[model samples]
Target: MRNNHNDKPQWQPATMTIHGGKQRDEHGALVAPLYQTATFAFSNTAQGSARFAGEEAGYIYSRLGNPTTDELEARIAQLEGYPAGAACATGMGAVSAAMLAFLEQGDHVVVADAIYGCSFALFSHLFAKFGISVDFVDMTNADNVAAAMRSNTKMVFIETPANPHLKIIDIAAVSEIAHRQQARVIVDNTFMTPLLQRPREQGADIVIHSATKYLNGHGDVVAGLICGSAEDIELIKMTTLKDMGATMSPHDAWLILRGLKTLDVRMERHCNNAMRVAAYLQQHQMVRSIYYPGLAEHPAQRLMGTQMHGPGAVIAFELDGDIATARQVLDSLELITIAVSLGDAETLIQHPASMTHSPYTPEARAKAGISDTLVRISVGLEAVEDIIADLEQAFTKAQQLKTIEQTEQTEQQGEPLTYG
Candidate 1:
């Protein structure tokens, strides 16, 4: 460990994650120090001028850069195999800043149709209001994506194993197509995280993350990250992040750094627990469909195996009944919390139609394969048997509710009622 700036060793991923971005002070403490100051004082006016003029390198203000944030950025960049990274205040902030950096008025963007609901709203509502045109396409189909591209197309934005539906897209293929047309490929890697997939190695020009999820591993902090080449990162940071004021706070950055140290271990458990839970749900009589890439029945199983190191923790399944039955299951569950966010240590669940995707009309929701009965579960690091027991109890409760409803209908009609 020579601390050579030019020649770092090619250590394994686990080692890199823990020790990659450490710059120690004179005390030589093992952990990186948090530089909490708002401004950096210069030795002289000439030195300050050089730092400001791009002739030298150093931090002038916390808004621009801080040692704690720099360490977090460096660790993430190394994990994602990128030259540089920019940390932002929130995931939406990262998405907005990155998109605004390269796109201008009258420019067109080809985006994946089944993106995060808020993201879809941002593009369809906010970006459209600014004169930037967007075409939504099924990114899983390469031909459709290529067809959607226009002469003014500046970017192809996608989210693999897309939110809620778990649709898979060929990142390398789309990147190649975009490059041929002189467009950039930006991938939202929030769902998969760096432990599961690295979009940069697969040819994406930029990778973004909602560090509020898996990166923090706790539900306490909200943050965002973007990684790419040094030139591209600096360009976006100077223009969008600086002007828009979406910079991450030093305290949040410190929390993310602490979470990063255990990312590999946490993700392993998440994948393991999720696979077992998905298998159990697939065999349930009340479950209409189960969507988890770890299941061999998944359409994207083969591709996910090829591209990602592990299947993610989130699983979406539809109930055989209606929205009421879905609500019953959520209410009966004793262990898992019903919540919007995911990737925390505790198991969580939510219904997409009435909660996350309520903004979308029925027709729009159907197009994205989101039905009223669809329920999403974010498996946590709980014991497999206990999680299964909770589900079994929930199913029993749902059956009882159906029986009581049938009895009430029979009494009202004054005739025999069929259980089917």
Candidate 2:
């Protein structure tokens, strides 16, 4: 929307979720109609030339922009309280565009040691080949980030309530360090979403999300978003997004737009269920370590509480035994899904070491805090009691099977096994 004297009223979160940044069609459809066309028609050659010359606001092709996608981007920007944003075909699309948009061949990027596996690969491989250097640092300590910053550093990238481990990074602290070096700060707010944590408000220059996960919430679409100032988004739109052709489809954008309407309430239930599940796991004998920041024992509890409204749905815990036993417990889960993706309505669980982060070397995985015995669960909207009951039974089954396996191994070795 262009700036005008009759600007719409800015609503609060609840009200915005239902009515913010809407582009009403002539039919007055309550839900935005899916404009599934690839090309838009102009009234005349002069009008088309005007659009191409930037004198008019109009979409020429779906690859550059689509009405449906624009509506979603507008809504996301509104929710993030940013001047502009871009919706992309997939989560990595947004990540790649945001990085390539600002980075030059000799520029350096400082990133948190923990991020999505693909993000690490993109930085370590593709970006490296182009002469862009990246430093992966322990961002939990603000000083570590400050120390990593260089005169050549152009961006500081981080993920809060970070992937798999749920380590909370102080966005304000890192942003403070980056701004001193004249570097931009970009944060992946996938885990907590804007409802729980708004990174832009915490001094971050840009915010990105895997809209496929919590943003969609129904496991139906793969999408991403980048939120920042209009000038930054425009640079990405005209270059990386347009040339790479990572534009979100009209249908996918529509689905994500639908998701925005319920994000506030769904996040509320997600946080509530996760807190209950994390509390239950902490006291369980089979659980060796709990990685939910909501727990008081978590190293980042104070910082997390200050930065975010809640800990969110994803929780990581390590087992008392080996990878075999962890797999056994995951396989034994009847209610919780054994899928890799998170933020679905159904409970989903997976081992990051063998699943998401399998592409990384053992040392790399270790540095990222992904362990063989670790299991990450995306707590769902199910009744807290039922979710806990399912885990309880699975843990009991895992222990029994693990004991049997140990006994058999002992017998094979001809060692007399004694009772503990």
Candidate 3:
């Protein structure tokens, strides 16, 4: 029930975030009020039967449907250009439900190697116990994706500008490969909110988000979203999502709806700040490597431009030393908070080797390209100068204090520090 009044006139994208999917009553409240009921009453028993039998179009219970949650789903679906969407209690809830909807027990799933740690654990341990098989491959190379496909491959799951490492996968290329094999393509579109990238328009069969990150923007709420065709979402709603009972609450839905309003402007500042931070890190003497799609030399630079509007807010880099050095940088930060979640209003930083991706062993992480010295930074809506100053001071302290050696050096021009 989007605010489709003729007077509203279907305002543009920026306006849609504020005014889209709105439902109001005779009171004419400016914002969508919370429909706090756990169940909706029918006029009579026949109406109730019609709702459960799918013969009528009304909510029967909170688990199946709620007005406030429906409005939030409608707005996200419209924004992401998907025919329909579903709300979940957490990001993983959306992810698990989507996979379970299309994939059978014997079906195979091809996933990118550098995915979120918890997702890696899901495929490796949880699904394997249930007879589902998975393959982890580097998706930056389109050929790697194609090679991993099998006749039983039912899905190709990927994350563009992937978690922690910030690697960009070619959505259109992977989607084409999967579709040709008669497989469904699912893209984790969390890092680059719908404002910056549209995976559905790029040929993805489904899109999922850790709405707790960019979609909610603020750190207070936790929610997940799955966006796709009506048929697919209906299947998930009737089966996997519904049976699991991982429905989002009306209050959390309202909070995420509020976050979507400022998402566009917030992302603009985040991208701006991250690009500046990445540039500074690239030239620093104590930094060994930087991973950001915004960097001109990034491996996925060409693909990032064609697939994404911005390089995104998160940046990952490696210090010249080991875990102790990475820990020092986390402790030395004055402005950036030591935290894991990204896309927040405040800058946050974490040591991925011990924090976000710790579920994987050292050997597995290294094979997946996460180094012991890697530091993942979620740049926020802060001044570029202040953020850069904080990083510079941390680098100095981490190198000098941890190793007891001066990090500053008059290295030959055009040469940056290197680590084996």
Candidate 4:
């Protein structure tokens, strides 16, 4: 049974992370026990049939349900302020399950122009093969979303502080527009986990998370979660999740359960470190442009403390030079790891054009405002000063490389290089 928070004073986020969906251990253990098994044994054939028929609430198979995974789902759902949730093997599993469950052939989906690279590929390439049409639009302006909706538009997908660029979309405004046309809003809440922003409370119909990132808060496990009303979650579980076989492993679920206990505090450090990193990038001469909501110069800075509790840990910026310059800086960095994923204890930096968003064609990426020179970083739990110092040295080395390259070019041409 779920813990009854209503019986006591309302739990805060930190408390909720530790104890929200947890049940007392009948064995008098401090931690919830993991139910690692393929299937549960029924009392009798009649009981087995009843479970298969959904006439009784009991685990039939690991794919259909597991006690450990169930607790993870319940914890996330409660954190999202939703009635139910489904855990998946990966973040894309959650995205596909949520969309495929509700969408049908000939259905049109309106989506944010900028989102995770894999998510964009899923809709543009795979969905087309199934006869579903999609329109990628700028959700920052609610009017763009309104204009894109159609009579057959069954869903609208978005990512606030959109991937790689930190573009802030107005969740409530888009939700209002989509709801008017009978479309449900599915929000990818990976960047700003429920600890930072609850999309359901902001009018989103469904919320998705890459449990591989912030939810797991470790580089070890890869998983996903979807939270929504009980009906929607049931629909997803019965359809895509059940048939696709993307259910999360019991071991992974248990790791995430342990990770969630530290989520509230980790998010605090992430936000704090990110704000400082963003500020440093803003004043740096080599950073041509920075896209972090915490910075006052960001167009969507106003959304902070209103739609979101804090400006999350991810930051995207452009260097003074071209893509080569960005690569040089990345290669020169000594401290931050050159990696694709985020929300781990160690800082990670990657080039969106070549790494994460490579699925998008050049034209599509341009339209989405993801420049070839853009660098995205997930500020980690390291000392803020050390992170800045590493970035500072990297930028200096990149500048030195640029000067040497210019000199070599001038020598090869037998003349000084000139700039317009």
Pairs with backbone N, CA or C atoms under 3 Å apart (clashes), candidate 1 = none
The Cα local distance difference test for each model comes to: 0.88, 0.88, 0.86, 0.92
lDDT (Cα, tens digit) per residue for candidate 3, span 1-420: 434332233566677677667676556777778888888878999998988898998888888988788888888888788878999999999999999888778989999988888888888889899899999999989999889999999999998888878888888889889999889999999999887888987899999999999888999988899999999999999898889998898899989988989988998899999989999999998889999988889866676646787888899998887787888888988998998898899899998888889987877798789888998999999898999999889888886785443332333244667999
Best first by lDDT, ranked: 4, 2, 1, 3
Candidate maximizing lDDT: 4
Q: Tens digits of per-residue lDDT for model 2 on 1-420?
A: 332221244577766766767875776567888989999999999999999998998889998888788878887888788988898999999999998989989999998988888988898888889999999999999999878888999999998888878888999989998999889999999998887888888899999999999989999999899999999999999999999988799999999889888888998999899999999999999999999978888876676646787788999999999998898999999898899888889899999999887876799889988999989999998998999999999999998997898899988889666998
Best TM-score goes to which candidate? 4
Candidate 3 has a TM-score of 0.92
> Could you tell me which residue pairs clash in candidate 4?
none
Each prediction's TM-score versus the true structure: 0.95, 0.95, 0.92, 0.96
In candidate 4, how many clashes are counted? 0
State which candidate, 1 or 4, has the greater TM-score: 4
Model 4: per-residue lDDT, tens digit, 25-98?
66766787888898899999999999988899888899999988988898999898999999999999999999
TM-score of candidate 2 on Cα atoms, chains taken together: 0.95
CA error at residue 345 for candidate 4, angstroms: 0.3
Query: How many clashing residue pairs are found in candidate 3?
Result: 0
